[model samples]
Target: MHFKDLFVNVSETLSFTTILLGVGYLAAFIVSVLVISENRSPAKTLAYLLLFFLLPFLGIIIYYVFGENYRKKKLYRLKALEDEKLQKRLNAYVYQRSEEKLKENELQLKDYEKLVRLLTYEGRFPLTDNNHVQILINGEEKFPVLFDALENAKHHIHIEYYIIEEGFIVDRLFDILFKKAAEGVEIRLIYDDFGCSLSKKFLKKIAEANIRAVPFYKIHIPFLSNRQNYRDHRKIVVIDGEVGFVGGINLSDKYQNEGMNNELFWRDTHLKIEGEAVRSLQLFFALNWSFCTDEGLFFQNEYFPKYEHAGDKKVQIAVSGPDSDHASIMLSYLSAISSARKCVYLTTPYFIPNESILNALKNAALSRLDVKLLVPGISDSRFVNAASQSYYEELLECGVRIFRYKKGFVHAKTMIVDDVISMVGTANMDIRSFDLNFEVNAVVFDEEINQQLKQVFLEDLHQSREISTAYWHRRRWFKHFFESMCRLLSPIL
Candidate 1:
């Protein structure tokens, strides 16, 4: 064939391939727009649209893998229905008692009553009194009490954790669990598959011991499932439905500084609760377990065994996740911050705040409320750290004192407002914790516990280096540029 004929054939083939590619891109873009338009967040929709238009093929793949709204998918509707039924069953007696108690102590709890009602009505969290709470500072303080509770459990033990790595602490806990299971005590354990990378054999071993161990939203094909992004980040352990533990510390050695690993000293906080509050924790665990395994669990008297009055502390267990339209935990935080009369103190490992929380903090600071934040000096994620730092200047300018914990990584997700209210649990100051991950927080309205947490905050402050407005503004140009880039991706981070 002649050269001219060959060139003409090649050009025709290229034209046909280009037309097909253009049609494919158009199809993908239309599908993306149709799917993403259902959500209410304009910023997130715009972000998705921009990514689709910029890189149609890869962007669609990424969105399919991580961007699907689990709430809209109705992934946890069954669990929610079960929860509603349980709530209805308990509503009559629980609310009546709660109201009577509130009226009796109206004068003392006047300031925190609104918050209690908010959680009760909006978050579906029950406010209960006659509870005892102990604040555990770190793993060193938390493990011993947790182990003792496990050893003493007489009935059933329920545990749900985000991460349960293979380590000395976990092994020790597992031994106790195995022994308890062998003793005919009911044991049900739920761990997030994405967060806990334990071997299948390990899970099988627990199952062989007659313990019901299930993974929360297990990934069947890993990269293909959108559920990988939404994790059960709660760390809860209910022993015999009487004593319970909840907080930021997972079952791992990193949380403990035994001079074994080269990692920095870890700081965290957890709570041990006894009395009616443990019933709430037990309910939370049962609901989550039912969600993960399709097991029908109902509230029974056995799970809420009558206990002697432990103390006079008031506590509520606030939960939030993608199952609901409202971010309950974030709303709770906003309520606490807005209601602050004297001060707001918080410590979190990640500090990527959404616009509402950011604005809340800024407004609180501008109002001359002593708003303070303690974050890690060295973060685990570079992108998250940069995104967190990007907001430092704005918060600092608004008089929100920001502190970088220099002694170690401050992993405690805790808050204290006006020495009247305290919150400690697994929710971080990030979008994921508020919207994607299932999180639980203990909201305590006891002045004694609040003051104790406040003192702990002051001690943490002594170890943290305050970030000055001038120093934050003096960052290098490249660093600012990088942070700005990371901030743009903060919505999905």
Candidate 2:
């Protein structure tokens, strides 16, 4: 055949194939919807089907990415009710035994008593005792403590992180874990697939060392399931039914700033808690384990031990996710912000906050509270970085002090309200953390904890570049265009 004839034939064949693929995809989606509807609520099924019909290819991609169906509200409501019933029984026991402890600590945190009760009612966490928390500022302070605790594990170790990669820091930690596993310590490990896709080989080495590892919401292949919007964004580590670590720090060299990706150092915060608070961390892990593997956790056996008084710091765990009707943990942060009487200091690598949070900060600052926000001078995501600036114009106009950490990126997710209360964990001030991703936060009502967090916040301010009204107004038109584009997709971003 002639060249023109061959080209025409190929073009026609490709077009026919495309039509067939699109039609097949639509049919399969329709079939999935019909099948899912039988086992799902009417409203839930309608929403899922509408999304698939409206977005077509992208919608199907979303369905396969998330780990579970949207029928979670009703299902998990039952689970939550069951959990709450058991929790009330435990709370009564804990409250009676720790009454004196609560009185002692509550007196110290009297300024935040109403705030704590308000959050407790919001279902973020219950009041607990014999809890001690340490704010780990960087990898320098966090990793060593984490490694030390993991090294001393006796009974069991459960960990779930958003990212775990093989690098100089992780390699040595893996070495310790391997030795511990050899010693017959029960080790359970989990990481998010989307966050740690490149770390698969690293996890393989862990598997070789006989550690039980699973990827959450996997997407590459052979994954049990995934939910596009439901991410396991939590970072938790519980060891020997005792010490635990929870914060924004991931297992990567960049977190330490010892290794740089593209010459930008990643900064973050991690917390080390020992005492009654560890029970809350352990419960958080167990619930996640049950969600991933369908194993119910009992308070008997070796899952929990008789936690005693240890350090003096008071800590509580706050949990939030898509499973909840509202983002309770994020709301608790808002409550803390509203409760601020003096200063509000916040640090996060990604500052792509939603409107409510932006308003919170703006309104708080306008109310004459010193609201200081710190983000990275050079962002890992330029689109979000630009959008982050768009709000700066408004925030600055309303008296919010904006600071860009110049020496390196401020990847820490931390906030201290009024130098009296502090919140530390995996949540960021964004739609993804509040609505889509599973997140955990530790709120400490101790004066010491808040002071330490404020100290770190102040030290970081030394290296931060303050944003003036003039600077934000001088942003170029093209940058503003991309900012607007990013803001439009903030829900998905």
Candidate 3:
């Protein structure tokens, strides 16, 4: 074989390979474009196209990271419409329930009206005298309150959370539940499989005690689907028919202690609503149970028992999830902001705002409404932090006051308007909380409750340092670019 013979054979093979690759690339490109265009924004469509052009293989992988949902926007819209219908039905029922008591609770008429409208709009457990709300701040406040409620469990104790750990805090809570179960207290625990997988053994212990510890939306474990998209981000503990808990706090030691787990001094907030609100929380739990277990859990005699409005505060519950397209809780937040006469004070661990929320904040500031934002001094999510910080300059320029909580992390998700009506619960100021994640937020209207939340907010505020417009302008341009990019993807994120 001479050099000339070898060159001819190799060149012919190379030509054939090139042609095959080109044809394959074109096929994939066309398929991806067709698939992506079905539901994505124009910007996302173009971003994807450019990526595919630059690196076909890696671009597809990135698509896999973000290109979920069969037809996200379409599905979202359908869910939203269905939710709207549910909202109307729910509102009617609530109004009927409250209208009867509206005259009795006449002094709190505006509060009741707000509660009914907010609950109806948000699909929160319709306000009932049989339910009550207990505002549980940190672990010091939540644990003792929750433990006592668990101890008093009668017919059943329904528990569901996004994160359930096996730490000392969880162990203590589990022990109380375990002993209560032995004493004829029915206990059903549901934790998100993905979120609580780390505590599988602890969950197993509950199962071993003849208690139901079901993993929701579980993967690969026989019955459950691996869809892994929607999760039970809600944290609610319903004890019999009289007591309940809902909010940001999870069943984890880190949230309770200085224990570290990728995050330091974990800060989060939660609610303990007894009385009629507990029934609403229980209803929310039942709906989730129906979705996950396929068992119809109507508020039958088994679940419903006699109770009264143990608390005087006018409270409304708001819930949002993948099942609902309207982003009800987020809408409620916007409503609060829009109606805010003097100030809008909000605190969250994550501050990544969606376009509508971002625009609302900007406009609120521009309108000269006192807008103060509180976030962690040390953030757990850098990308989210950058995205949050990205809005500082414009906000500050428009007279918005920003504060970084010097305390470890401000996980309390509270939003107060005119410093009168305050909301405290699991919902954060981000698209994830607004649109993607399941969340529960409480709306409190009574002056006393408002003052209580305000005092706590003020104490937290004392620990926060104001971020000046000058300081915001000093941030690197690259950071701004990254945040802006992150903001663009906020819708899908």
Candidate 4:
């Protein structure tokens, strides 16, 4: 109990605490340096830096889980190589004619030639002719057509989706799949592990039915799974290499509004493509299948059968993800907006665009282009909704017209630009879709399809409440501040 002894003990405790603090700050500094070295966008780098410094150990955990800018290329490199080999083997004729098609498209589309070429080089998605594209609105139209296509699969059926929730719709889907399997038609399915909840019993049923199925980037533990950040968000269906479907609609009952009383009607868009475009969809599926199952489908002639002039529509498939060398979908969107000579109409469930897209819309509006955006009034995530709203004031100030759909969630990710192109696919106007997830869009370059999508967008406007600058600026100050705060973290959201 000596006073000198007590003083020594307290000094030792203080020394330990100081050493711990020093080590923690040193680790945070190292991580911050690494984040900067990743050469991420300025906003993302700053957000991650703020998190690392402000929250101490917690920030380190979050960054470890989600912030590391790791590309999935190493895992997908084989798929990429296989795709390259396949393209050389099967598409030499298409590539040979691509220049001629480019010229034809340049003359046909006029201002969209640059956009077409950008996708050709950047996305590695060749423009194809002899495509028949049908714009399917909502699940009501999509399911009937999809079921019929599934029922008619003579060779093989490849289905991939982010969600395949168990419901009557999925039950019916399985029934058809089982019948197809029994009929000796090859069936393969890929579902996102993070997005779908496939019961063990249901998975057992899938196995028993002799239908090959796998989950993309399977996660065992939810909390400790860092791979959950990168997801396969594409919804694609390729049947017999003749028919294909791509869009935002997942294989879930909620996507269909039939027989619903109080449930929110999910507004969405899908493309039913029959022609050369189906080969592109099948190509993506095969690449993803190779990644997930290590099974090469590159040489299957039935999976890539020759088509005999299905229609006259021209279509190109745009796909992007961490595996991609560039953010192809985002670049395509930027090109579409920048190439808009008259109007830019966009409808999305999420609207957390990056700096380029945000500025592109503002610039288009400032140039007196008729720019319109339709977003969801009732978003499933409040954080995403608030962050989306934060961009509106600036857009409105620049004379951009913004509308909020009131009837239900407008989950359609579609854009119509100047009656030249219509884009419908899974990529949202957000950082997640642009950079993190696997996404695909069918870009249609037909006047008929463009006009149809434009008309649908106009009809959607009737149900959306347009936001006036006066009305937006008059909102409460706290709401604005909260939205701004959320916007600051949007790059990583």
Candidate 5:
């Protein structure tokens, strides 16, 4: 063991370590170049670059699984193709009527022509006038109507939910579905593999009851697949082509306060539609069903039955995802905000907005319009809450009033604009909903529904505590820093 030999070994070890570090950094730089070349949002590009350089190995794994935009497009390409094929068939029958309906509602929708035109130009989203829209406040209000509709289902039941947790509500739902199936009604369900907690035993029961259930983008190996990011975050139910449901509420008992699992009072929003608008929801379900099981349920008469003037309400369903040509839901929000004449009130469980949305809100407030945001006082994710809080100071400073629901977790993704337009659906006001997930929303152009939603928003304000700019700025320095850090990393969250 000579000292010269030991010194030589030490020098060799240092040389090896330096080479490894250099190689790792070089790989990170290469990936950063790829990320930037993808033409992604600036915030997202910066987030990926920071992750790559700071935590090269783990960041590479994350980017491999989640950051690859091409993988998402490839995953949903088939669905998009199938949708285009079906949309043509729909246009032959539905689009013509939609155009006529647009003309019929032109007087009421004059202020929102840009929003309507934006959505209509995106294609497949039709504006229907003969829709009977009902605002269901929470699980308590929604479940009864939904169960009644399920019980009255004559031909078939089509349901697609992001989450289907096992609980009393699900038990009741299964009972109705089983009975309906026994009565010769066709039943099909699509649940998100990433969102559902259904076990093998529960699935066996669904199969035994003769209900065809499939998972969206089945993840064979959890740690390997990128399907986790591209989720079907939609909650929709179309029964017999006459009744439809859409909103943030999932098939979980947590959304209901009367259930045995009602530990927390959960606040949410859902819509029940009984008219031509239900056909739009049916189309969305058919697309997902076809993607999951290759079952083309399009152009079926039973799924797109003719309506006889269910009501005078005008409704349009807006959907967006990675497969979409444009971010339709976000555009709808931005349009709604910018077009607002009197006020814009938005309620969402998540509040991580991108640059466009943030600027839109600030500009709206700066224009002397009443722009208010209602978020959760008690959040399920601390990091998300912090990230959401980071934007509050700026919004408040811009004269945009912010409120935190103190009564419960406000899980409603809703927006009311002026006196003639409103939105309720599954998309949150966050990056995930804007870019990563499949989301659908009902943009109602009826004054009655708008007033109803406005009333609900006003009631919720009573339960929420307004955030003052001074108070927000007075938050602890460490918390401000922590939330800023979270905001910096929010693009990936």
Candidate 6:
């Protein structure tokens, strides 16, 4: 029983244990790499790989919690199949009608034919005429119109929002919804579980009041649910299948400047549509409702009731989500920017653009088109803000004028091209909105509305501070380093 012999034996045992741990880490890393690569982009794959390599145990836990590929899940696959079937059934008829309408007003829509065709063929969004669109500047203007439409709901009311915090505005909206429900009006609601975070009692109260409320992709097991990353970010309100509203303004006090904190002011854009265009929003709601509740409600005639002619604006609803192969809304923006013959104007809170959109903006600026982008001077998320600023130098170098809204947070996600096309929606110019969240935008092909949007953009510029190329280049070294780090993580942000 010599001490030297015992020491040698202990050293050998410790070495064996270390080898076993190394093998386990290698196995976990390999499995994570395989699973994440199924649907993630190269940038994301590399980021996750680096994460796992740096911290094996923690990265494995993080990947299991957040990096699960929901695209490979059967639930989303089934939903996509259902959407495709519905689109296939209606696309041909819609395309034919759009073509006929274009021929009838060839001269008026001639400039927008290519854009219309792009949305139709790629996004499967059919352009419909005889629609009316009202540009709502912020929640101050939008809420009143929305409340009036809700108060006038005769048949049914449908609402879907990412965030529906309990507040003054939400309480008012709930009271109205309850009143309408009591009056024999059918009410359906879909709110995101992560975004809304309402208690069971609140949801039960709404259910007891005769409103069919459902949480989108409900998280049955809390943190165990990988579906948290794919949120239903759309803010939609449809009344009697005739009038609808969509935009970035969620149902919360923060959206309204009066209800907001004294130091904060909310700036956003929403659209009020009446006519056949409302049907597209209705369809989006119905499909999402069906997916969330597992109910075959898309065939209900009440949700798609025939509409009387409202106005003469042509509109289309472009939707994108994890269920789709391509980022339809992002592509729509890229197309609009690339097709701009006069100018391109855009406003968004998050300006983290993907390669395609960045290239489009650069090319548009290089072509001497007046390209302008407005972002918030102060963002809610510092990392996101830094990532947004990281692109300022490149865009400014290419002749793109960048402005930061100093009055308040510019939460509006809008784009206007050539004074002929305008889009307002929930999608931001970021990877999360384009690839992860379910978003819908109203694509308007009308000169009048586009001009109005252009005017609004100009007014916003008055409240913003323009970032000159020289100023961007002269940023401090530490600031550049911090922004570069944020940009590195922007792909997965």
Residue 442, model 1: lDDT of 97
Q: Candidate 2 clashing pairs? A: 65-227, 66-226, 66-227, 66-228, 67-226, 67-227
User: Which regions of candidate 4 fall more than 4 Å away from where they truly are?
Assistant: 1-24, 78-94
Q: How much lDDT does each candidate structure score?
A: 0.86, 0.75, 0.71, 0.88, 0.88, 0.85
Tens digits of per-residue lDDT for model 3, 82-194: 46776577658777775665566667554335545655645634544433445677776788788887887778999889887777888788788889889888887788887
TM-score of 4: 0.94
Q: TM-scores across all candidates?
A: 0.93, 0.81, 0.84, 0.94, 0.94, 0.92
lDDT winner between 1 and 2, please give it. 1
| Model 1 bad stretches (over 4 Å) | 1-28, 78-87
Which ten residues in a row are the worst by lDDT in model 4? 72-81
- State the lDDT of candidate 6 residue by residue for 195-263, as single tens digits: 996778888899899999988887877777667788899999999989999999999888888656747
Candidate 5's residue-wise lDDT over 349-459, tens digit each?
A: 999998889999999999999998999999999999999999998888889999999998999999999999899999999999999999999999988898999999999
Q: In candidate 1, which residue pairs clash?
A: none
Please list the residue runs of candidate 5 whose C-alpha ends up more than 4 Å from where it truly belongs after superposition: 1-17, 78-89, 92-95
Model 4: per-residue lDDT, tens digit, 419-477?
A: 77899999999999998888999999888999999999999999989999999989999
Clashes of each: 0, 6, 15, 0, 0, 0
Candidate 3: regions farther than 4 A off = 1-37, 40-55, 70-92, 98-118, 121-132, 221-228, 258-263
lDDT of 4: 0.88
Rank list by TM-score: 5, 4, 1, 6, 3, 2
The best candidate in terms of TM-score: 5
